[model samples]
Target chain A: MEHGTTEPGTAGPENQAVPDRPTPTPAPGTPAPGAPSSGAPAPVAPATGAAEEEHRPSPREQERERFRRSRRRRDTWIAALSTLAFLGLLAAAAVASPGWDRVHGLFLDAGEFRAALPEILQGFWLNVRMFLVAEALILVLGLAVALVRVTRAPGLQPLRLAATVYVDVFRGVPTLLLVFLVGFGLPALRLQGTPSQPWVLGVIALVLSYTAYVAEVLRAGLESVHPAQRNAARALGLSGSQTLRHVVLPQAVRNVLPPLLNDFIALQKDTALVAVLGPLEALRVAQIKADYDFNYTPYLGAALLFIAVTVPLTRVADRLQRRAAQRTRAEAAR
Target chain B: MNEPLLRIRGLHKRYGSRTVLRSVDLDVAEHEVVCLIGGSGSGKSTLLRCVDLLDVVDDGTVHLGGTELTDPRLDADVARRRIGVVFQAYNLFPHLSVLDNITLAPRIVHGVPRRQAEETARGLLARLGLADKERDHPDRLSGGQQQRAAIARALATEPELLLLDEITSALDPELVGEVLDVVADLKQRGMTILMATHEMGFARQVADRVCFLEDGVIREEGTAEQVLTDPRHPSTRRFLSRVLDRR
Candidate 1:
């Protein structure tokens, strides 16, 4: 109690002469020392100056703080220990399986995978080329369809209806069926100008199927823009096409960028379906090698190649999605 | 009076059997400031919107500066270029800078050169007290600053008539004064204005003529002093009293 009184006197010379500041510090330090001498005025000064400086917590507050700290430490240890135990149990179970030797011989043959790597890499280049060409076509086709579907002009109603039907029909049909139909049916037509190349037909089929899904995603973004914005643009004397080209499309594309990337990723994976037409894509090459060696490890090599390309793209899309969400929240707060 | 700057006769508007404006007629002389005052559903906003051709009239004619504006054969975009409109909530394009919002119409619709349009936009921005905010987006501005920028955008085209629909209704109490001051300045410059407002005091102070709308019609019309201080209609008195009581 004496040290508490002396500490305040040393901390501030003005407090020693004030009589009010020194009285309160000592009363809390030694509450049972004397009530009438210190307790009466002590409560009033501290209550008013509570916010001015940090004070020692009461026993109840100290106990609550200690409980919270220990609970946080316990939660961290429980989570970490449970994750380690789960992984260990899985590994132990895998080692003790009766079919481990046979499964390893077929699927995990490291020598067979290494032997197939060079040819799989060469075949993967074809898949990449198809993906790049199809992606460009999909962007243009999808944007055109979305623009037509969103048009409000009375004269364009027929075009809008046609675009709607195209999207519905294409999205309903599977990509593999589209590839088969375009690859086989176009050649069967025997049209003079149509190319009979399977890869070209494969690219067209991928674009046709993916454009429908991407257009719907873009249309959702366009519709989310408030109608007030359209009214403002119209009131400013901007024509419908000018408004769409400048105001509406920029905002719409920005809003739906992550979803557009997701569709492109799906397109990349679906390029493998082109193999049904006898193209030497990564998957087809892997299947041939696996059948020759009587081992499934080449399939694993093809899967790894696909994963290597897609994982970076997936990470980029996730980062962009997070940033867009953050920007939306900040705009809302403003 | 040298042909009214704007004329509306037999204007009718309805939304699926619910009539909003029924055979409304109004006239505004050049350089005159007319204010429309009404209750929530009194069709003040609808009448202004119809005059601007933002909403199509069921049956009517609107003439601006001796040119018929309601003809269905006329290109609405070309016609809209001659008029300026400011809305409640200050609908400034959120994605563009203040200067770009002001210059978009003149550069795109009127075919003004980019540098010339930007010069005019900068002058308007300076006059509106937003000289330093030319490059700032709408979300970065206060409500009053955004409304002032909206006014600058509307004035950039040098329109024959300006339509303002409750411009100060969306502003904070302190911010409302700055927006009203811009309107007062526009009136001083003799811009032809047809505005709808809920601010009774401002309407009385700045308007040359005031029209009281009630249930899809103008119930009373006169000079601002006459309609606001000594009304001829009982509904006008009731509406004013309710508005004044809240103040």
Candidate 2:
């Protein structure tokens, strides 16, 4: 999906700019001097020297400046053209559709959207609460599992195997199925002391599935730490646990922050999945309103709310990843 | 004269089928600087690692002040606390500020109070000419400054013996002098040290004794003047001539 968007966005500029290069200054290989050819050999040296002095900026610098200017112009044209093309396609599709007005009435009616907002907003609060609880639980569980997987002690083999198995099974099972099993199947058994609330069960399933993925991310981060750091920690007389706590885990956590945030963003969207159990979360509220009013505007409203919550979070993750890359580059340069 | 601060008797180290150290025996007295000179892959680093109990030796023994360090029953962490080591590269923790790197061992390993550890760390940093860089991370420092910070960290715990394994080998030629100057300063302060290096000039200048190692064995050992200037073994003579000729 990313490749599809970026390819045309960049290719348009290059294609438009290429023809302009060869037309002007066609003999790029030849260096032109303003020296008049003289029959006398002595004047040749002085004339060429004078010609060289007359060239204010070096040819290479001049060409580079020209290239920069052309590139800027090409970028501007690409942006304008791509925007026009995209809007034109949408307009053409709207004009060609046989039921455009009916589709618009069903999906874009402002009155239906306004009527759905209050209940959907209330439902979104439940999603927010569940996401918060699930995120915290997942972080703790993920770090514990990652630590167990990375520990090298022979005595902890059984514990390591169990943690590994937990990760594998949870990661392999579709989250939707796990949600169904935990939220619906478990409560059907009528076990004593079991909390049968849909929201609680949904949060449990989300935490279980996310912990497996986040644990693998954390494990990769732990493995990425240089062996020298561990050697230095051990040589300083720190015990294995102390070395991990003080030396390894801090660096690993920093390395994995972007991915962990990505996982949280996914969890935020997945909060809507609780509607499968008939809980009146945002999506469920939207579904009921759409069915009652016979308008899809409520579904669009719910989607917009999800986007509003996730976009800023994604931007934050991007900034963090950029900063991390910059730090590594600076370290390498040093 | 005094009981040797570190002793290795018939130390044998192997990785799978290949032996890195073969029946190597050496002793380092208190306040003495012993330099190990050899070509690459000649067991210099392996011997130093074995002494620090970083590497489990296949056979033989390592003793620190007459206590057996290599015994299987001994706790390696307790033995390692008495020995400080600086590697060729990435010696300082990049995640930590210079001061934190220096004080980590003292505070965590020795159970020193935070205030005392910071005090010692600041003094060491000042002595190493990095007093103003205490708050800076290792990545922000130049290679020379990073190495100096690493040395200060190694010295912060005041270990009984310091092991430096090719510490200057990874440094640029211009930066090598500053790190060697720190080692020379440590020697003047009478720190017991065992170092491995290819820098013959620095070794000749700073080492009290020099041992020439060839194929995991000590071919010649004596004072710096005798071993470096006039070696008895044919292999040592050839190695030194080749090294000097390249210079």
Each predicted model: what fraction of the native A–B Cα contacts (within 8 Å) does it retain?
A: 0.50, 0.50
lDDT accuracy of residue A129 in candidate 2:
95
Which portions of model 1 show Cα errors greater than 4 Å? A1-85, A152-158, A323-334
What's the CA error at residue B83 for candidate 2, in Å? 1.1
Candidate 1 docks at the CAPRI level of acceptable
Task: Give the Cα-based TM-score of candidate 1 against the true structure.
Answer: 0.84
Q: What DockQ do the predictions score, one after another? A: 0.28, 0.32
Whole-model lDDT per candidate: 0.85, 0.85
What's the distance in Å from true for residue A67, model 1? 12
